[model samples]
Target chain A: MIYMKRVRLFLVLGLIGLIPIMISGCLGSKTSIQALFTVSPDKQVIPFTANFDGTLSYDEAGRIVSYTWNFGDGTTGQGPVVAHMYKRNGAYKVKLTVIDSRGRTSVSSITVQALNPPPTAQFSYSPKSKLNDKYVVGASEWITFDASKSTDDGTIVSYNWNFGDDTVGTGKIVKHRYIWPGTYNVVLTVTDNNGGKTSYTQQVNILGGPPCNSDISGGDTTINGSQK
Target chain B: MKGLAAVVVLVVLMQVSAIAGGVGLFAGAGPGGAALGEINQAITLYNRLLDNFNHTPTITGNVPPIPKMGSGITYQAGEQFWITDDLALGGKIEYFRTSVATAGEYQSGGKKTPISIALDCSTIGFVLTSGFNFLHYGFTLGVHGGVGYYYSGFTSNITFSVPSGYNKTISVHPHTGKGHYNNRSLGLEVGLSMVYPVTTWLALGVDASYRALTAPRLVDAHGIGLDLDGDGTAEHINLSGISLQVNVSIKLDLFR
Candidate 1:
């Protein structure tokens, strides 16, 4: 039994001696093939193009035969230098793998961040059409305001309007009219989900359309094109 | 601002009456350098917006480089009254302006946005000066110090874009019209000058002045501070800077 234990210890020592040789063979030489790359503008807003260059990679024992890229967005490419545009916003881990002529491969990775852009503000108003380059609307008439023309990459949380007459309203589509006949500045302010705010202002002229009996319009006046 | 300047003029004019000897009119202009204070804080505001995505911002396309406020131009017009041949007292109105206009891009990891910005600042000072003219042969060497009221104006047309999560672009403040911010503060200045004798009535002079001025508060027409860094407090304005100017002075021996 003691002789068998000595034999087992000898085998363990031999295994330890062989481990380094196996690792050395796998590790290659001091100038072993390395997959090194650089990414320009790795961080950007969505719909952004990034440039990747793997020319800095080197293989001392053999020529590098292949350069493969995994953009982490479920896309792949093959080249020494390539440009990729991120269509969506997210964190992407880009990988570059270089294979030498000897079939040895090395991999490097970098994290790319694509950010979201802000929403643009736009809107169109009806019964407030342009006449001779002027926005004209009849006073005390139904003027429909629409913000559907406004766009956002995400969701627009709120649409606020300042009717320039100390009256305010909210929604994607609203109706407002001036009480007195004059030129009024209509302002539409939109807020996106990201808390970004944008405003659009249009100067609209309100016509009295000759003298209207003020006695008949009293208390029955429709300032917002709605009967009070 | 005008009210305070008028009061200061009365106080200085009384002092001039006490020691009237001779009078000289001077007008000068030159390059200047100053601190931008809240005006530059707009860039910090821009960076903070970009940093929201947890990505480092790489800004490209700016003049004078970012974070380095800028250089400016100064014009001064004033009159000095000689209390004696070597001693004189003066009052001058000086104006200084600096401008910055940039259309650039901010890039983070893989995304980018465009930005267009314009900012111009002006400072007007009404000051009282005391000078000791030491030399008067080929060149006149003198040193002077002054105290005054400085009115600062900041005009901004700053516009920066951000991305909506939905793949659209929007302006942070589309209603951010051209806003003019104004502030006023008391100022202290000291300067040295050397004048070359061009003629009996005209002398060409070069002046180097250091002004120390700070406005504790700056506000817009709506009484709102131009707080760009998300900080509720408005950034103070610093008009302190060095100005080197070339001047032409007409000296007359009056009531001598």
Candidate 2:
């Protein structure tokens, strides 16, 4: 009888212990809150704006009543979502804190990177004319390539040109003379101080002048030992 | 007086019979006669991460242009309690992640510089669902709906070679950073599942779900701002899509 009584006592104590655990598991839902969030376009070129949303933050058993944001730039905001713009290039840390209806809070954070914008490539050539007239040019004719129309956010430092006739030059405006008439390709490459570069290519046709000995060679050009 | 006493006794007996019937109904109700409770773990083949990063530009050949987001994977675990034969209430936790890389060259002043870019993203959250078992035969068909939280973000890294005209070569270092965002606007999810029971307690299932949430804005740790749409204001990232999952579930008969 005593052994049976001890077993019953142990069972009652075990059940009492389990009662608290079960109740806590079901009723303590709001005790742990997870503060979560996301940032769009996290990496960007300078003069950038970023958007922040904390709608994904959650309370385990309750509802989130408020959201607070710290932009890491000495700026703060209150809401479930917010937006900020960075004017310069650098790295910044953003943070979000969410409070549940039960006064429990959770925090989340991320890093944002902003870099200087790369130079844009834009250029125009002078003498806006087509090489369609027989696609021909006189021998020893001079052709000009002007890359002054190219633009960059920063100053353009240099221009390199390949005349496609075993010739190269350096300048914003370059002139090349083709001695033997043929089709030639002209290429221009522009570079900025930041090492940014862009290139453009144009085709030119240079027609060879009439052969100097066209008439003398056809009929009777023969050596003393050999005749045709 | 004798008739009143007899009527009272009859009413008492009827009440006892009704109570006994209610207890019998509760005892007989089970989850399709297989079990009264279940726990499931699933592996998800998710393609939605690709939609989230589709607009960010990356290095490609000679140009830096935007590329499509890549596919990803997720895992989830859930528990359900059947209150009756056909209806159940449950909750789940899900985790997802993805990563992608791009490389290209930037050319200028007759010189070419190599550039590389990479992105990594992850998410973790929970949801509560109400499910209905609509069909039962060789296989069981169930449908569910829920509201939950979705926490996600990405880390981006960019490296570029030093340009010409610098007296000293500046060592190229990768610029890496993370942006965190969240959606709390009552995220909604709907799913359909078909399960084939191998035994009384174990089942294999295929589940397809569609989830929708408010678009979250990405903000870097540095608190930098971005005007993605050029409207002079900041914009949010879109992180909504569908998921296909394969799951294994085990039924527990403790309640029954």
Candidate 3:
């Protein structure tokens, strides 16, 4: 009877020890939290705006309750996603941290690069000629082109001109003469140090000499022949 | 037909033994006799259908969806060892081949250019399977789950032609060498087999099974960009599909 009592006591103790293990198994497995995000337009010219998305972040056992963003430029934000603009050219490291309902946390990060903006191109020519509208000029007369009015955020490096008459020229101020009497289109292209270029075109109609011929016939002057 | 012939020969041998007072080479076999032997082998032919392909980036708003693969087929061989009366552990190797067609048009500057793309994809993989078999009078039903590594190879050709009367007519032909991607995923298989037991040492079975795997990302080889969800990144190819197969299995008692 004493031996039976000892066996029963041992059985009870073993069952008590197994209770916690069985309950834990029935409760299900625990999973670690995962954080994910994406940055749109990660590389662009300043001033640049980037959009961040952390909607893909997940918590295996619970829901994500909060999201925090640190835009390496020393600015912080709170949300599942946010947009930030960088005014200067530099590289910024963006980080996203997510907190689950169970107080578990995970972090993910990415790098964004911003570059200097391209220069704005502008130019104007002399004689105020409009290509779409008509402008008249004398044959064999010189037309002047000036690209000195062109502007850029950086230094203007070069100026190129297409005279539209199978001829080309280079300089800020250049002159070209059209020998034939027909409509011609002139184009001016300016380039900045950053390789940015802009072009302007104008049209001009050149007229030939007057249509009359004078001949002295037999020592007597007569205005007889029409212009050829 | 070859499987049928094998089954016929086995049945004839078993019948002869039965007529001779059942004192055959495989007589007096019990449940515990070589229970952990090679009990199943199969050869399967499957038909697979894939999801739609990724979209092209240049085409905007209301473009037709990308085309699906034209033909898909897989060949597989599997072997299993019986661990208990109703449980088995095994592995299977498979080879799959398929062809994809991509054709579209882009309109820019009042000109329409037609593009054609063709790709051939092949994959080889092996999976470890754990299954439970339920035995009836002459039929066995089973379900299995597997995890394995898969490697896929892709080769593609792209061509585009610009129409005449354009300021400049252009043609582009981009060649992509063989590209490969690898992944590990899980698969599920369920099958039913009819077992014709001819002798204690051999049986001929016919099986029909269905299998599926998780979809893996497929990268474009020609550098075509697609933003299907309005995200900046290109969308990946979808490879999720179901496969149906009919197999001829030969069950053997290797220990006997």
Best by TM-score: 1
The per-candidate TM-score of the B chain, in the order shown, comes to: 0.79, 0.62, 0.51
The model with the greater lDDT, 1 or 3, is 1
RMSD of 3: 16.1
DockQ of each: 0.01, 0.01, 0.04
Model 3 steric clash pairs: none
Tens digits of lDDT, candidate 3, B131-208: 555456766555444444455544455442332222221111123223433344444343444455655545555444
Q: Stretches of candidate 2 above 4 Å error?
A: A1-228, B1-67, B107-112, B159-185, B225-232
Prediction 2 global C-alpha lDDT: 0.54
> Could you give me the TM-score of model 2 versus the true structure?
0.37
Model 2 CAPRI quality? incorrect
For each candidate, give its TM-score against the true structure: 0.46, 0.37, 0.40
TM-score of 1: 0.46
Candidate 2 local Cα displacement, residue B18, angstroms = 19
TM-score of chain A of each: 0.50, 0.55, 0.54
Residue-level lDDT of model 2, residues B57-84, one tens digit each, is 3312342432434356656787765544
Models sorted by TM-score, best on top: 1, 3, 2
